[model samples]
Target: MRTYSLDDVYETRKRRDSWWTVYFVDPVACRVALPVANRTRMTPNGLTVLSLVLGMVSAACFAANHLIAGAGFFYLSFMIDCVDGKIARLKGTGTPFGLWLDYVGDRIRVVLCAGGLAYGQYALTGDVSYVVLGAAVAVLDLFRYVNAPQMKRVREAVREERQEPDLLADADPLLGPDPLLGPDPLLGPDPLLHPDPLTGPDPLPGQESERAGLGRTSRPRAFFRLFRRLNRFLARHRVRSHLVSGIEFHAAVFVIAPIAGAWALIPLAALSGLLLLANEVFLVYRMWLFTRRHGAGSPQESREHVLV
Candidate 1:
C-alpha cells in the first residue's frame, strides 16, 4: 500500500519466492506469518541459522516418507527463511554479514528441498530421479559464480575505456606543444616549432610544423574506432541486458513456477538448473568476445580496481 523502492520489492521477492517455497507450501500463510514472528524476537542471523536447521529436519522427515509432515516442516523452514530478513529490517540490524548469511542459507535450503524430494521418492518409490536432479541443480549453481568473474572483468574494462579523454582524438595537440617549450612565456623562444639540432632536418624544411603533424593515427586506429562503435552498441543493449534477463528467468521459472504447481515441481527444478548453467555459458562467450576485441590485461586490471 505504501511506496516501496526496488530494493524493497527485491527483498520481498527473496523472502516469499525462493527455492524453499518451491516444495513447501504447507500452511499457505507461512509468508504472512514470517514477518510477524520475526517481530517478536530473534535476529535475522539467528533466524537464518534456525531456518537451516528447520530445513534439515524437513529433509529428514521427507526421507522418512512423511509427506505431509515433511512438507509442513519444509514450509516452516521456508517461513523462517523469510523471517530472517524481516527480523533484520524490523530490528534495524541488517548488515553485510547478515546478507551473506542469508544468501548462503537460501542455497542450503534449496539443497535441502531437492534432497528432501529425492529422499521422499526413495522412501516412497525407490526412484533415484529426485536425487540425481538435486545433484544436477547443485552443480549448476557454479555457473552464476563462474560467469560473474568474467562479467566483472568486462564491466571494469568498459568503465576504464569510457573514462578515456573526452576529446575526440587521443593525441590532441593542445595538450603539449613541446617538451622544451615549458609554459613560461618569458622563455627564449617557443620550443615546439624550433628545429632540433640533433635531428638531421625536418622532412619538408619550408612547411610549418602543424602541417607535418596532420595525421596522428594510422589505419589500424581507424579500425579501432569502428570496433569501439560496435562495442558501444552491444554494451548498451545486448550482453548485459541478456544476462539480467537470464537472472530473472532463474528466479521466475526455476523458483516461482514450482511453487505454483505440484506435478510441475520436478520439471521446473530440472529446468531451472539447466537454464542457470546456460546463462553462465552465455556470459563466458560475451566476456570472451570483449577480451578478444580489447585485451585480457585491460579487462583484468579493470576488474581488480572495481569497488563493487
Candidate 2:
C-alpha cells in the first residue's frame, strides 16, 4: 500500500484554489480520504469515476427536489473530486486518459446538476424561469471552462519561450491565441493538433500551480495611484473570484432558492447575468491587453498583464 503525508497530497494542488476549499473543504476532505484511498488498489481514476457516479445520483435527486440527498451527494462528489488528484500525486500513476476523464467529467457533472435545478423548479412551481436560469448558468459555466485552459496555455507558452530562447527559436513559431479550438469529433477519430500538450481542448493541458504566496501577482501594490480601485480589484482578485462563484451561485438555485419558490430563480438569474457580463468584459479586455503587451514575444513577463 502507498502512504503519504498531507503535504504530499496538497502540495500537488494549484496554489490559487478557492479560499474556502483551501481553509476548510480540501484540508479535511482530501487528507481524511487519502489514507483510505491509498490502502485500496483503487487508482485516482477510480476515485474520479466514483465521483462521477455520485454526481449522477445527485443530479437525479436535484431533478426530484430531493434537496437533502442531493446536497449530500453533491458535497461527497466534490470532496472526491478534490481527493482524486491528491491520490494520483501519491501513486505517481497519472495518465492522459485520467486527465481527459476528469476534465470531461467535471463539465458533464455540473451541467447535469444545473439541469436538475431547472427540473426541480419546474416541477415544484411550474415556472419557466427555471429554464432560463438554467440556460444562463450553463452558458457562464461553459464559458469559464473554455476560458481558463486557453488562457493558461497562453501564459505558459510565453513562459516557455522566455525560459528557452534557443529552443523556441528552433521550434515552430508561436500562433496568436484563439478563444476557441477547432471542434472535436461530433462522432469519430483523429490524432495530433498543437504539439504542446498544454493547449489541448477536448482534454486541456494540465495546470502547473504555484503556492498562494507565489500567487500574489494578481493584487496591485498599495499606494500605486495610477489605476482605479475597481480595475485594481478586478486584476487582483479575478482568479479567486471564479473558484467559488459557480458552485455558490448554483447552490442558491439548486439548494436554497428552491426553498423559496421558482420565482426566486428570476432575481438569481439577474444577479448571475450581471456578474457574467462584467467578468466577460474584463476578460476580453485583459486578453486584448495581454496580446498587445506581449506582442508575440517570449519574455513570459507578467507585468500588469492578467493574461489568464
Candidate 3:
C-alpha cells in the first residue's frame, strides 16, 4: 500500500474555494481523502457515485422525517463530494465523464433533498407552505448553478478584451494603459499619438481628460473596498470571497434548518436565498458598468474581449 500525507491532500485542494467548504468541510475531508487515496483503489468517479448514493439516503431520511439523520447524511454526502475532487487532482484521474456525473449528481441531490424535506414536513403538519418552500429551494439552487457560468463567461470576455492588443489600443484613451505591460517603448512612441488606422483618430484633449477623470473616480465604493479587503484576508486562508455561495445555501437549507427544527427552516432558507440573489445581482451590475465604461468601440473591436 502507498502512503499519503495530509500535506499531499491539502496540495490537491483548490487554491480558492467557498468559505463554507474552506472552514467547515475541507478540514475533515482532507483527512478522509488521505486514507481513501492511500488504501483504496476507488477512483474519483467511484467516490462521486458513493456521494450520490449517500445523498439519496439523506433524501430518504428526510422523507421519513428523520431530520437529524438526514442532515448528517447530507453533510457526509457533501464531504465525500469534496473528497472526490481532491483525489482526482491528487491522482490525475479526473475524466470529462466524471465532471458530467458530478454536475448531474449535484442537481439530482438538491432536487431530491428539497422534495423530501417539503413532503415530510407537509405530511406531518398538512401545510402546503412546506411544498412551496421545497420548490423554492430547488428552483433557487438550479438558478444559481445556471446563472453562475454565464456570469463567469461575461467576466472572462471582458478580461479577454482587456488583453487584446488592438482592443487595448481602442480602450486606452478611456481606461488608460494596461498596468501589466506598462509603456511599450518598442511599439515606437504612443499609439495615443500615432493612432492605429483600424482604431481611427485620437480623442479630443478634453475627452481624454474627462475619461481619465471618470476612470479615477470609478474606484469601487467603500462597501466593495471593504469586501475586497475581506477577500484578501480570506485568500490568505485559501478561501474565496463568496461568503454565502451555493454550498452555504445547501447547508442552510438541509443542515442548519433541520437542526434548528421545522419552525426555523422556512425563515432560514428564505434569508439564505435572498442573500444569494443579492450577491449575484451586485456582481451582474458591476459587470454591466465595467462593459459600459471599457467597451465603447466598434462591434469588431468589442468582440475581441472574450476569455476562455
Backbone atom clashes (below 3 Å) for every candidate = 0, 1, 1
Candidate 2 Cα outliers beyond 4 Å, as residue runs: 152-273, 297-308
Could you give me the TM-score of model 2 versus the true structure? 0.64
Compared with the true structure, the alpha-carbon lDDT of candidate 3 equals: 0.73
User: What lDDT would each prediction earn against the true structure?
Assistant: 0.48, 0.56, 0.73
| Candidate 2 lDDT over residue span 117-155, tens digit each | 778867888888787777877887788667655655554
Q: Please tell me which model should have the higher TM-score, number 2 or number 3.
A: 3
lDDT of 1 by residue, 161-209 (tens): 6664211111112222211111111111211323221121234555545
Candidate 3 per-residue C-alpha lDDT over 1-308 given as tens digits, one digit per residue, 9 for 90 to 100: 55889998888776556778888999999999998999999999999999999999999999999999999999999999999988888877877778788889999999999999999999999999999999999999888777665554454465566664433221122223322121221121233244322223445667655544655443443334355455556666766555677788999999999988889889999999999888667656655755665564454654554322
Question: How do the candidates rank by lDDT, highest first?
Answer: 3, 2, 1
User: Where is model 2 poorest over a 10-residue stretch in terms of lDDT?
Assistant: 182-191
Stretches off by above 4 angstroms in model 3 are: 159-220, 296-308
Q: How close is candidate 3 to the true structure, as a TM-score?
A: 0.78
Checking candidate 3 for backbone clashes, the offending pairs are 161-305
- Global CA lDDT of candidate 2, please? 0.56
